[model samples]
Target: MLMTLLMIIFAVMVTALALTLVLLISGVHTFSTSFSPLSVSLASTLFGLGVGLLMFGGALLLFLISFEICKLIVKLITPSIR
Candidate 1:
């Protein structure tokens, strides 16, 4: 049951990461099209990209950690007959 919950959470995180990537890509296109000051536009674009990447990366890391921990728990719980 715990593993199932973790799997669901992992799925949600993956979905969020995909959405974030899409948003970041759209932002890049918007920045490219707008006629804004070079310095300001560059700063904002970098900041946005950095934040998006960080969120996606953090989610992925958490999902991986949860999966490993769950796998280890399952291994420990199940009886093995040699």
Candidate 2:
């Protein structure tokens, strides 16, 4: 189904992006610089990913709630419409 395909694609893309970020962080040389880009990138990426996931969860929850409300209304109105 389209939903399953979309989910699979999203999972793959997220995984790829996270892996790329980690790899880039690892590739940086820490000995030459007082400030490590690795740590900064890791922290920022973690925060960003966490916020994104939270937002996604909130949106999904809202969607499900709205869907259930719509379903309930449809059920309540069906008999009258008939």
The candidate that wins on lDDT is 1
Model 1 worst lDDT run, 10 consecutive residues: 73-82
The superposed Cα distance between candidate 2 and the true structure at residue 2, in angstroms, equals 33
At residue 9, give the lDDT of candidate 2: 50
Candidate 1 runs further than 4 Å off: 1-40, 80-82
Score every model by TM-score. Answer: 0.49, 0.47
**Which 10-residue window of candidate 2 scores lowest in summed lDDT?**
26-35
Q: Return the TM-score for candidate 2, rounded to 2 decimals.
A: 0.47
How high is the lDDT of residue 65 in model 1? 67
Which ranges in model 2 have alpha carbons more than 4 Å from their true place?
1-41
